[model samples]
Target: MTDSTKYLQALEEFILLGKSAPGAAAVANIQKCISSPNCFVFAELLELPNVQALVNDAEHKKWVEALKLFAYGSYMDYKQQKSAASDSLPDLTDLQLTKLKQLSLITIASTEPHRLTYPSLQSLLDIPTTRLLEDLIISAVYASLLDAKLDTANQRVEVSSTAGRDVAPGDISNMIAALEGWSASCSSVLTEIEAQIASIQASAVAQRKEQLAYEKLVEEKRKTAEKDGSKGKRVMDHSDNTGFGLGEDEMDLDDGPFDDQGGARKSRKGGNKMFSRKR
Candidate 1:
């Protein structure tokens, strides 16, 4: 069910067929494999003993080349060869052509993850119209060759994912380099995430310290205020209990009320008693 093996059963049939096929029969088998709607991966099929034998056969060597084109070459590769030597390679079936273009799309998307503009694909695949290109893209999506959106507004194909095609011997190095670049990008992203988390944690710690320090300052001020209030209360208590803060001109409570003559009231009472006695 994996992308690499999605068409594996169909390919296995070709392998089995090639076992009994001989001479030109092998070339026919290759043709069937390439033209099969379900078959996409061809490295295994190409390596079969019966199929490889076509390379030595003068009459069928071109069929082997045609198969190679399906396995790894793009649609542009076919066009170039057909243009240079019209009969050098076997003519591709419509289905075969469509499949090759789909595989080529995978190659292009892998190299450039974005920027699948309609114009670029049309130029590369020699597709004549927007409708044909869109149909091909939609077919590729349904075939599970790629996961992409048709950005009609943007006039582009936004590829989110793609299946791998058979890697030619020369393509191995490019694949490795791409993997290395991806690993480095992932490492950089991880480092950035770690730095952001550290910054957030450090900020949280600093804020906590500030909050604690502010609370400590408030507690200290409260204790000092209470202590100062206690000292003032003690001073007032001392002034009330021992007359320590009294002024010299302040009256004493022990003296009696004064009379109109500026004599003590006790003297007025005594004069009233004397007058009463005289009466």
Candidate 2:
């Protein structure tokens, strides 16, 4: 298996065996495990029933409570627990103090919005002075636990982002469910977009087909009109040629089949004879 699997297996064995066989070795191993970079492992170990049993045992009580503070509790929890205890707690090493400060920031981030006031954060961390708190925040920022801006004028810390932590037991399923929901939402939007594109494409194709059909009809009408116009022009030309000759023949018939001078003389003689007969 992978290194993570091996580490987890090793951690599980330690937690299970350490409960039945509590000693300097087990406490040392526990200390080593909590000091690991993986904060979730420390959190997971804190949740064990056997680990909680260490609270009653005077030898490992301080370590158990310290681990709890790193897991989910803030500096306030550490202070409060220390106040209630009859015995004196062990002094925190430099490394443990740094880790506690980091964990305390995480706890604060969980409750507050992006902007966190210096006073409130100082109260939670129980730092002696503002300078120390600022230093702690700076260190946490350097460790990449938080992305924050210290607004001295406003006396607030503005957090823009935070790094992801390890998943607690049974949290993986919830994370998967959230991811599946997001994927489904994205798929739905994609489907709607695809449908809209198909609709637009269909409309364009129909319009193109209609335009082609109209153009074809117009072309056919133009050809038919040209043929009809040519036929009508030929008929008009033939009628004009025939009408010129026929019109002259009709004019000659109207003149009574005589030359122009002879017709006039005969018409005059006919008029004289009619006059004599009347007399």
Worst 10 residues of 2 by lDDT: 270-279
Error in Å for residue 24 of model 1: 2.6
lDDT of each: 0.83, 0.67
Q: List the residue pairs that clash in candidate 2.
A: none
TM-score of every candidate relative to the true structure: 0.71, 0.55
User: How well is each residue in 1-279 modelled by candidate 2, as lDDT tens digits?
Assistant: 644455466467556666664545556656766565443335556666667767788888777766655655666676777788735455666666667767678667765664278888777766778898899889778766788889999988888876544455476798899999999999999999999999999999999999999999999999999999988863323245446423322322234534454432234223322112221
Checking candidate 1 for backbone clashes, the offending pairs are: none
Please provide, for model 1 over 24-63, each residue's C-alpha lDDT reduced to its tens digit, 9 standing for 90 to 100. 8898888888888788889888888888888887789889
Output the worst ten-in-a-row residue range by lDDT, candidate 1.
Answer: 270-279
In candidate 2, which residue ranges exceed 4 Å CA deviation? Answer: 1-22, 29-58, 76-95, 128-130, 153-156, 170-177, 214-279
